[model samples]
Target: MNTSRLEAFSDGVFAVAITLLVLQFVVPDVQSGKLLAALLGQWPQLVTYTASFLTVGVIWVNHHTIFKGLRAVDRTIQFINLILLMFVVLVPYPTQLLGRYLNSGFNASVAAAFYGVS
Candidate 1:
């Protein structure tokens, strides 16, 4: 197959992964007066969402850049690209975990590390 086919597939995966990131933002249950505070308190989720969104965007751009000059792709290249996409697809899961546990004292480190590894 052509490189364009691989790029297209990767693009779709990136789109889905980034789209899933936003699902982490839950509507807060709070009284009228405290709504703002509740929203503000979700800073961790917001931070993770922003970071993950930007990271995925950058990765997608870079992926395109790397493929721009390639004349053809071999089995090894296709396999490597699949591995990269595997990690890319896992981004949302770690992002959600990080957002959910980032503020937890000891758990924060682990969550951050998990996000970093992904």
Candidate 2:
């Protein structure tokens, strides 16, 4: 079943996803802007960073929960795990979308929808 590879792949994906979450909070460029205005502008990034961070953490915890139940794996399970990671890796996109657009009222609705799917 290549158990070692399975575990290694899963761990790698989790690490990358966690890294992506943390990477979202890069210091924004607020050149020559009022301090309060800049803070307000970057608030969306902060909100999304928090939400995506929590989402990755929650899923990583769940990954541990599910893996702990299984004593072994086969090809089918390996592919299934990879598919799940595909979604996990994709999380940063919607998260970035939410972060960039969240200030708009329309963007707020989009954010809720994105959260629902996430």
Candidate 3:
């Protein structure tokens, strides 16, 4: 019935999800003179990474706030929280997809939609 364990587990999931977002950013292989240009080329990934990071951060804060108000967590609540954690864990995948296809015409739209749905 205690919420502490649930909150702690949720916090761990959030931390892992946020950490995974950064793994999407692979260092671009480029010559010294073209480093700036190479980095600039990955603007889409950077944008997606930032968006996903902020999204996870905001969700974590909100989850903490909501859990604080609950005196106890029931089985129903635990199941719902698991569902939420499932989605939280999935964030990085869609983020990577969106970033890779964000500028690729129709795929960009698909990726955006997928990102939104996720």
Candidate 4:
């Protein structure tokens, strides 16, 4: 019922989610001459990764602030927190999708919408 346990669990989930965001970035394979171009081609991935990372960071901060004002968490609060964490963990999937399809013409808009919904 204490906020401590909830905060600790939420922090762990946030840490894991943020860490998983980096897994989407694979090193580009290219010859020395083409390395620059190959790396540049992954702009979408970089953009999505940065955006998701910052969003998670902000969420974590806000979560901490909210918990700080509460003495204890009730059952309803716990369930709502669980739902929020579920969406937090689901972030990487949308981030990956958006990054992969951001420059794919028609799929770009779909991916953006999916990411927004997520």
Residue pairs clashing in model 3 are none
**What lDDT score is found at residue 48 in candidate 3?**
98
Query: In model 4, what is the error at residue 110, expressed in angstroms?
Result: 0.5
Q: By lDDT, rank the candidates, best first.
A: 4, 3, 1, 2
Query: Which 10 successive residues of model 2 have the least lDDT summed?
Result: 22-31
Show how many residue pairs clash in every candidate, following the order shown. Answer: 0, 0, 0, 0
- Model 4 TM: 0.96
Clash count for candidate 3 is 0
Better of 2 and 3 by lDDT: 3
How do the residues 1-118 of candidate 2 rate in per-residue lDDT, one tens digit apiece? 6366677788899889878866766565666756668777678788888878788889888987888788889888988888999998988878877887787798778876986697
| Candidate 3 Cα errors over 4 Å, as ranges | none
Where does model 4 exceed 4 Å of error?
none
- Please give the lDDT score for candidate 3: 0.95
Q: What would you estimate as the lDDT of candidate 4? A: 0.96
**Superposition-based RMSD of candidate 1 using all C-alpha atoms, in angstroms:** 1.2
- Taking all chains together, each candidate's TM-score versus the true structure is 0.93, 0.81, 0.97, 0.96
Q: How far is candidate 4 from the true structure (C-alpha RMSD, Å)?
A: 0.8
Which pairs of residues collide in model 1?
none
Better by lDDT, candidate 3 or 1: 3
Local lDDT at 79 for model 2: 84
What's the distance in Å from true for residue 30, model 2?
A: 4.7
